[model samples]
Target chain A: MKILFLGFGNVARRLAAIVTDEGWPSRRGTFPVEVVGLFTASRGSLAGAVDLARARAELEATGRFDARHPLRTDMTPLEASRNLDYDVLVELSPLAIEARGEPAVSHIASALARGRHVVTANKGPVAFAYRKLAALAETQGVRFLFESSVMDGAPLFNMARVALRGCRVEAFAGILNGTTNAILCHMERGGSLEEGIAAAQAAGIAEADPSHDVDGWDGAAKTAALANVLMEADVTPFDVERRGIGSVSVGEVRRALAAGRRLKLVCRACRREGAIQTSVAVEEVAADDPFSLVDAYGAILRIETDLMHPLVLTQEGPEVMDTAYGVLNDLMEIAGTAERKGEEP
Target chain B: MKILFLGFGNVARRLAAIVTDEGWPSRRGTFPVEVVGLFTASRGSLAGAVDLARARAELEATGRFDARHPLRTDMTPLEASRNLDYDVLVELSPLAIEARGEPAVSHIASALARGRHVVTANKGPVAFAYRKLAALAETQGVRFLFESSVMDGAPLFNMARVALRGCRVEAFAGILNGTTNAILCHMERGGSLEEGIAAAQAAGIAEADPSHDVDGWDGAAKTAALANVLMEADVTPFDVERRGIGSVSVGEVRRALAAGRRLKLVCRACRREGAIQTSVAVEEVAADDPFSLVDAYGAILRIETDLMHPLVLTQEGPEVMDTAYGVLNDLMEIAGTAERKGEEP
Candidate 1:
């Protein structure tokens, strides 16, 4: 399998190192993956079968590329995706949630147009243009899998596809954003929101610019993506009734906790009269509710299905490696599908 | 898809009624299923495309069956499996944990030898001869799926296969038996074990003879099945270090509860020193542990994997319908495979 990575930031770099270390395809009987292209906005791009190990080393030694490295080019992700030779494209660009999924969307569209499968952790492309991208992938005979778009690789989409086979999901609620949840948890325990955000940022769980996390854009994007995937609703993040944890005061958090409730940034999507309705807001969850018990770094998705009633899937901790594993998961699934059809993986 | 029910017990009967009501193959775009045969230990056997609705009605009217029912004969499951024609055989016989999976093991072998796919709720066949039966099914080009053998329809095996993907599971701990967990939870709350058992029986959660559940045989069987499926171990119920909730005293439960810990019947299987070591026993779990929060009727499976860390799967309220749904889930999966292969389902 020939692969290319777009936006070689922390996620892409980690994924590349793991792929290189595990000898790509990792001896688990899947087809060997050869990274054919590497692209980034500022760190330079490489085309035509770049050395992944050397690229990873260069990134580790310095913030960007070692200029002397072979195959380094001044190309962007969109340009490389259009001109490069690859079978699968991994999109790891920073999410442009409010910009209607710009560079990542274009990168994905270009790859799909060229008959290549796309695996991504970027939420913008899915939250903004899921239907069109999905249609294009289906039309082009490729897979557009984004298991990390929601809940940081907890296998939510795969759960809907494989585990909940033939069962209809009536509703779903989750703590989609780890940063905001952490802040709220801290506030509930007598810390200020700023204190919690700083703690999370210092721990590398939150980004420097905490606007998206605090404003609930991350949760809204995830909710929209899930609504699109599970409920087949052509909804975007903008369509969701978005409310962030910023409005949740420390006093309110303390009051809720005293009243046997925990204030949480809950992302909920439910099917009402055959249409999907979604919201991302601060809700008071009872002490017994599973959502109330999830830690700041952990996530939990409660899906109400026709056959299984309410099925709870919880992840103990979320990490960057978890997001990278989601991409690998999608790749393995694509390979498994090919293998099932008796195709060379 | 022609399905044969080997044992017309609660699970089988519920499945048949659902199939009849929903007109089997219930939407999700798989092949339509027709119940071809129905056999029971004492209720007699019906051969050659049994009318599911009529059979359901007959079973509902009489606890067993009426002699006047058409095509009824005094035939055992093994005999029916051999003589009757079926595409899939559902092994819903009474679990013989102490018998080393007697009738179920033989019956499964008979069906697989005849090139019929097998879906079973009985844990015995898997606990005793999982590798052999799996090999037989693979050799015969059929699937031997037993999702209900562990945690009813909680998606344990499916989670391992689909969600875990190439990720290796290092260890797994679960409350596999609902009845014992219920008893333990009740004991923690100052109720007697007998009282808990009686309440469970009243709620149709326990069998009339609760020896199998209270003796830890059920948990041991499930542990062996999981060890076989997840670790690929050739182990049986006899191999596990088994201790039931019967020996747990009320004082012990109270003391644990007072110490911010809950006593649970935890079934653990782990890869220790390159060998699978498993045990089913009453253990004291901390209040913060997810396993401690699961209710008596609810079961929780915490799997430690290479990539996903400790992934927790909790199913609230294991019921007869839940087990029936597991059988349906497996059937749908088989049909999905056939559909993908473009075969007549």
Candidate 2:
């Protein structure tokens, strides 16, 4: 099986390295998977342009790669489809829902239409058009997996759909975004709300504008994915009632701390009166509670079930690198299963 | 697919109830699994004597049952084998390793030899004779799933084997036994060691003797399971260094608390120089750390991998009921795949 990766972003770079290091093609039981080519963003360079010739020479010296295929980054979706003879596509690009129309989405749609399996760390397409893309995947008889879209490298999607199977999921809630959680933790530590936000930006944990992370749009998109795909709930972005952390005040933060509580931005999706309701809000959690100790970029999910007790799963830290690894992990599962089923691979 | 439960312990009772309540038999998308009969340890009054009779009654009222072959709790394994007809054998009997002369192990072996698929929550057979039983399962082309054996209801086996595929696991450490953790947590909360033990007994959380839990034998068994299955490290029960929380003192717990740390009984398995080492010890964890917040009966696994960072997966509240549910969850996954493969329903 030959694989093509679109965009040399953090996720793509990490995945490519893992693929090579794991010896995908030569692993004892592997089904001959090979990373054929990589395409970066039009503005970026291949493998960060660390001298492809030099890199290839080094890999050859180490007896790792016999040959390296360098593809131009500026190819259109149609161009990529016609030129690439790969069995699977790894889509990792900057998430853009409105303005740029997200190259990852178009690339994924094109790959699926071409009857190639598509694995992605990109949440844009899944959150915006899950049903459509899923149907397309079925029609093409390929797999479309996005485990990293919700909790970075954590198996949030798999846990909900597979691990917690047969149990009636009464509700699902979590501290989904790390940036907002980091800011909340800072404020609870006596830092002013503005100071916390500035600290997050300084640490490169938050974007300059930070609208998506701070305004809860990023988390809303994730919650939508969790609801529709994981829980099989029919819901959309517009259905959610989002309240970002931008409105939280320093006084309120201090007051919460004084009362032995910490302010946490929580996202929840649950069935209420036979309708799925999604909400993002800032709530004060007791200092002794598990949510109170969630550090910078840490995520936790509380799945209330019809059983005697609820199931709580958590993951710490917010490294896009892990999120990238999560995407690769999902691909491996789908690819392995597909190969076992005597598919194209 | 008819299932005959071999025991009426906590796990068996819970699983029977869940299978019935879910309308499992009528769920056509997956396997054609159905609960046909149940056998308890006691005779005559066994069905009525069971604590959760309401759950049993509810299942009987809705779920299809073979009236001509009403569940019998008194029959010997050999008698049941000759008289009853079941496609699957679910063993939830109390674990008895030393009593190898007893029927459980032989019954399991007989079930496998008869081409009956086995799903067990018992650890005795697997922990004692993993190689023999695993070989038997493979020879018979039947699934021998024991997700509940290691960490109660957590997806430890599935996560280590399936979720973390292709990743080089360096080490794993966990709080494996909930009963021991609950006792330690109680002791940390100003109770004497003896008092905590009493509290556990009163709460029905600990066994009468409690040696298995307090002496670290229980965690040792679980650690063995993790090392052998998850890390693919060949290690035996005798190879592990076992140390429980029985020796912890109030002064030590107080000092650890003063140092902003908490004491926890930790089970660790690591590969060192191509050799596997397993141990159970007491460790001091920082208050703000994830393990510190793990309350009574909660279990946590910190899996160190060669990836960007370590991944920690935890299941809160160690309850047999939850563990039973986890086992049922595994059965569902296996049954689903088996059905898809056109195996015997």
The model with the greatest lDDT is: 1
lDDT per residue, candidate 2, A1-345, as tens digits? 677766555566566555556466553234554665556544322322233334344443553322343532445545665567888787776567464225666678888988888888877777777887889999998888887777787776655556666666778888888888888878778787678779989987777878888888878777777788756776656567899999898789889989988889888988889888889889989866788877888888877775425656677675877787687777777767776687756
Scoring only the A-chain of each prediction against the true A-chain gives TM-scores of: 0.95, 0.85
Name the regions of candidate 2 deviating beyond 4 angstroms.
Answer: A22-31, A35-37, A44-74, A78-84, A99-103, A186-205, B22-31, B35-39, B42-75, B78-85, B97-106, B113-115, B250-260
Model 1 deviation from the true structure expressed as Cα RMSD, one decimal place: 1.9
lDDT of 1 by residue, B238-278 (tens): 99999988878899999988998888888999998899999
Best by TM-score: 1
What does the i-RMS of model 2 come to? 3.0
Q: Please tell me what DockQ candidate 2 reaches.
A: 0.38
Question: Least accurate stretch of 10 residues (summed lDDT) in model 1 chain A?
Answer: A22-31
The interface root mean square deviation of candidate 1 comes to 1.7
Top DockQ model: 1
